[model samples]
Target: MTSSYGLTRLVLTDFRNYGSAQLTCDVRPVILTGPNGAGKTNILEAISFLSPGRGLRRAKLSEVTRNNEESKKPEKEQNSSLSWAWGIASTLSTPQGSWDIGTGLEIQEGKERRIVKIGGEILKSQTLLRDYVHVLWVTPQMDRLFQEGAATRRRFLDRLVYGLDSMHVTRVTRYEHYMRERSRLLKYGGADRHWFDALEARMSAEGVAISAARRQFIDHLLQAKAWTLGTFPQAELALAGQIESWLGAYSALETEEKFREVLKASRQQDRESGGVACGPHRSDFTVTYREKNRAAAFCSTGEQKALLISIVFAAARLQNLQGAGVPLMLLDEIVAHFDERRRAALFEEILSLKMQAWMTGTDIGLFTSFNNKVQYFRVENAMVHEKSVLIKM
Candidate 1:
């Protein structure tokens, strides 16, 4: 079976620095070399859009469109093409099959909306894209993940969980929607008790489900041998959220009941604070360097980066071992600091998993170690050109 999976074709228009761009590739690992400001990361960001949420940069949709005179024109003065200020069309492949993912911006209901088409049929919801494509990415922005806020760590964990279970996205979306509505009702004081009860019930249900997935994902990661048999250091993971802790002693139903009471009791506090205090939203994911027995926050920058790579490798391994679709890896500027041992390990993992990973770095020498195992590309002026690879050895 051809386990390699990822975009075989990608087209971008009016996105970031590129006015028009496209690339086609096979299932081999891809290496893009370019100087700073050459739009190397932009290509990775384009791939990230194939999945849910904002791209790796978390940039606003407006920020992604190329800034040109046409983009600034008045609505009536704009042409049909103007509505698509930014767009990404691509074909993503897994071992199971290939999918045609046509997604981009469109003007609907007097507002900008992202629309998706699979094989020329418009999808009712973007959530359906999850079933066909799974994307995982690491960028320089996430280099400080351990030092960053809890929200960042939570999102990182959720992305890993999403690959295994497609419904995880829907559960999270419903949980966040209810959380916001409940917060609004508490703040504005207009909703009825029945509405409050209904919203809390839904949130508790979804929150419990989210926590359960995270718990199971962590267990799989702990057991995955990738973390133990790699050049990267082993990372110890833990959840410091109330719901996660409650799962140890209380059953799922009991935890949901407990959460409902907590939400009811916290209404006044949440209202005054303008935020929910105790749901999965408040959960914090913590990491430790298992060998050193030190928190990730205390680790050196290089060590922190290694720990992240270790975790991602382990997650990919688990997905393949359990028969979940292998995720496409979009690593931006990842190998600049990698030592020889670590670099070789990363290459071995990618080849072993048969994952179509798109990796970027400024220096091509950092990647010559792969020799003939990878395809090389040169990125310049918002475009990618295929290049011949010359093995160093």
Candidate 2:
């Protein structure tokens, strides 16, 4: 039931540091090796956009566009002109067939808007890309997730949930929107009770859905019986918050009702606090090493990294088991932390999964074992060139 689809071709236009680049390769692991700031990670970020959300970096639309280079033209001409926008295009090969997918920024009325197209047809929403391809990523920024505040962990958990449940994003977005509106009303004072009640009801429904989706995704990962990699340790995950704690005591409908009541009762306190104090918004994602039973935040940095990688690998296996399709994996500077033996084991597991994995590294020797098996590329000065010969292997 694993997905046979992978990105067969990728083209970037004015994306990040890349002015124009195109890559054509098989569905094998793609190894990108170059010095830092060579735009290797930027390439992975572009591929991540094929899915949903603001991408791995969580970068803004304006930040993703190529910077406008200083033009020698007159100042008046420069004032009237706009720089070229960015775009990403890829050919996806699925079990059923192959399709062309493209996403880019378009200027409409002096504002840049993201646009998506599938098989030459424009899509109204970026969520539609999920139907064609699912993506999962591990970035260097996420290495310290456990030590960060609850908000970072919550976002990480939500992304894990979103990978399996596409609709989860919609529910989370609606809940956040209503929460903001409720906060504004509270801050301004003289809010109507009826209006407050309506907002609370909608927020409660969406909050319940968000919590349920997170629980379901975690449950599925825990229930999966996939073989664990010898180099990676399993992680025990749990959620902590007022709403998450109540989930066990009440049904979803009951939870929604109870949540609504709680919101109503806390309106005065919320008004004083300038925001809603109790709901899914305050939830936290907690993880521990299964073998040692030690909290992830207390584990050694290396151990914590292993735990995170294990969770992502297990999640991928669960997705394959559920016939949800294998997702493209974006591993940014992930190999530099592992020794030769662990790196080999990681490569073996990736091969077994049969999904296209894009890995980045500064040293080519680190990826010598994958010399002929992977499609090797050297990135320099925002330019990407495929290497035909093995480098010292």
Candidate 3:
């Protein structure tokens, strides 16, 4: 069955470059065409905030609020202070029904806090968002994922896993928190043995959970059927890290115990390094072209881009099979790099998946293949307006 859920209404207030905007459209792909610095990506970033964490840009909470023009005025002449807040509300139509989901930043006690509301009632935590919708995005910045350091790749893998397993976020957050506390204690050089042991025990438990979740995702991806009739090549996924290395030879429990021992043994080294010596925190993900048997990093630039797209497609399919409802896809300037044939294929795949994809590009012609099939919008001067005419391909 095709997905029966998509965003029907979106409203942005004091968000990024847009002071106020509302977009209404059917649950189909949305093509946003605009020049650079026209706030195209800002729209996608707002949608990304619907899910938990730092959103697509990984920006600070304060950074998302639109800078007040009044703030620039002379201190005595300014009419009002900036609200220092932003809001996003959307109507999500699912097979079960429709619900209004809202998220925004509210200043509390001189600090900005993220708030979530469903159908006008406040939600206690952002994690509640996973039950209503799943969001996936690709940005121009991600083009360098393979070429970047291991930390970026790890984050990429975690995001993919988070889509499949919502609890992965909580586990990762807890693991990182414990690791930070442990690192702080190590750095101080006077950590108590008992307290350090307690911290390591907690870290081991959460670390194993994080590693297990990642491994499960990788295993699922590896066994998934390859994409057919696509120009992109399938990727061979692998995990590299101390915890991942032990999973093959030991049960999770055993590995946790071993990890605790390793932590204790490496305390001096960790102290010297000023960080956790080894754990899931240091894990890395490696991708290879299945057919060519070459590492993704070694692939040509265009080939690498294609490979990334292939993996995203594979991930989308996997989520579908796993019964995650239709995921909203945000493709930022993705069409700018693809040829006509590839662009057509990309649109077809999105249609087949029945996903509500938000695509951005400077040239509307790149999305001519989707004319009349998707909502068209023009983003300019920090404002988004629906295009009146649909240009035929």
Candidate 4:
């Protein structure tokens, strides 16, 4: 049961536009189609929240509540008792045995909390859910990927890593908190040289380790580029980062010390600018087209879209090879750019990987080829309903 728990069931109560939503899929790809603003992306965002961090919305918990009560009146007269809830089931494996870990999300006016229970016993920390489910996603927001800052790409990279390695989250979280503390102290005038020194030392060590994990993840992803391109016929992926170039030259400990020393030396400059001078947080990826041998940023909009799909498929292949349980994929308005040939190939690759995916588009014809292999649903007004088509394929 644990082996095939990618998305067994999802229960939503007063969540977003839906008063109640009960969805079940036994680990197969799913296609969600509907007109624009039909709540297609909302389904994916709900699935994303089942994992660590914010959902695909990157929203605060309080922001996810539905306005059923609020919409009944003017914004100024609405009360703050509005709350929303959702339940997700995942598989958690331990040395002792494999068990089901179900989680719930509850949110009200300014507070959001996650509740977890394994098989039956209520557990502390939604982190326990991390043990069972690992999630990765790509949305329309990522369409202008290369044009964006490093933080977006770094976050995309981390999500990929998190799907493959759970511990990466712990490492990343710790590194971030450490950096925040160091930044706060640096902002204060009373901070001593030794205090800053020790904090930087810790940040340096964690930062290098975090960077290494990211690079290694990219290396694994690169290994699948050929196979990925052969199947998708779109774009190529190449990791670009100063730290990636520096990985083999030094050990982790040595890298940490070097980073600490560099930060110490750059303190005055960073303080003056109110920003960290250098760290893995500044790292980013470079996407390109293989046939044209050109960067994605310079490519046509259509070409960029194709390149992104190719990269996503490549990552999916890597996930399968890594035995990272079947990944739940989300694509928001990605198929509109693809020609028929590329669309068919996309379906083929997703089917071969045996992944559970959710894709959206306004044109139902875009997913007609998915018959016999994909579950099709039409989304409208926050209601996702299965569509039975009579078209002959």
Backbone clashes for every candidate come to 0, 0, 0, 0
Among these predicted structures, which one has the highest lDDT? 1
lDDT of 1 by residue, 1-393 (tens): 235577789899888888888888887888999889998999999888888888799988878888877546476747544366678889877666888888787765457888788888888888777888888988889988999899999999999998888899999988998998898889888999888888999999999999989988998888766475466899899888999999989999999999999988888899999998888878888999999999999999889888888888788888878889679998888888788888888888888788888999989888877787788889998888988877768
Candidate 4 residue pairs in clash (backbone atoms < 3 Å): none
Question: Candidate 3 — which residues are off by over 4 angstroms?
Answer: 70-84, 188-192
State the lDDT at 20 in candidate 4: 67
Residues forming the 10-long window of minimal summed lDDT in candidate 2: 70-79
Model 2, span 1-393: residue lDDT tens: 223678889999878887788988778888998888999999999999998778998899878987747323357543663533688999998888999999988765577789999999999888777778778888898878899999888887887776688788778878989999999999986678999999999999999889989988888888775538766878888988888778988889999999999999999999899988788888988998989999999998888777877888888878778777668999898888887777887887787788789999998788888757678888998888988765675
**Alpha-carbon runs more than 4 Å astray in model 4:** 1-5, 70-110, 114-128, 189-192, 229-236
- Against the correct fold, how does model 4 do in TM-score? 0.85
Per-residue lDDT tens digits for candidate 3, residues 263-365, read: 9999889888888888998988999988999999998877787888887778888888887755799999888787878888889898888989999999888
In Å, residue 335's CA in model 1 sits off its true spot by 0.9
Please report, in order, the local distance difference test score of every candidate based on alpha carbons.
Answer: 0.85, 0.84, 0.85, 0.71
* Residue 365 of model 4, lDDT score: 82
Q: What range of 10 consecutive residues in model 3 has the weakest lDDT sum?
A: 75-84
Pitting candidate 1 against candidate 3, the one with the higher TM-score is 1
> How large is the C-alpha RMSD of every model relative to the true structure?
2.0, 2.7, 2.8, 4.1
lDDT accuracy of residue 55 in candidate 2 = 91
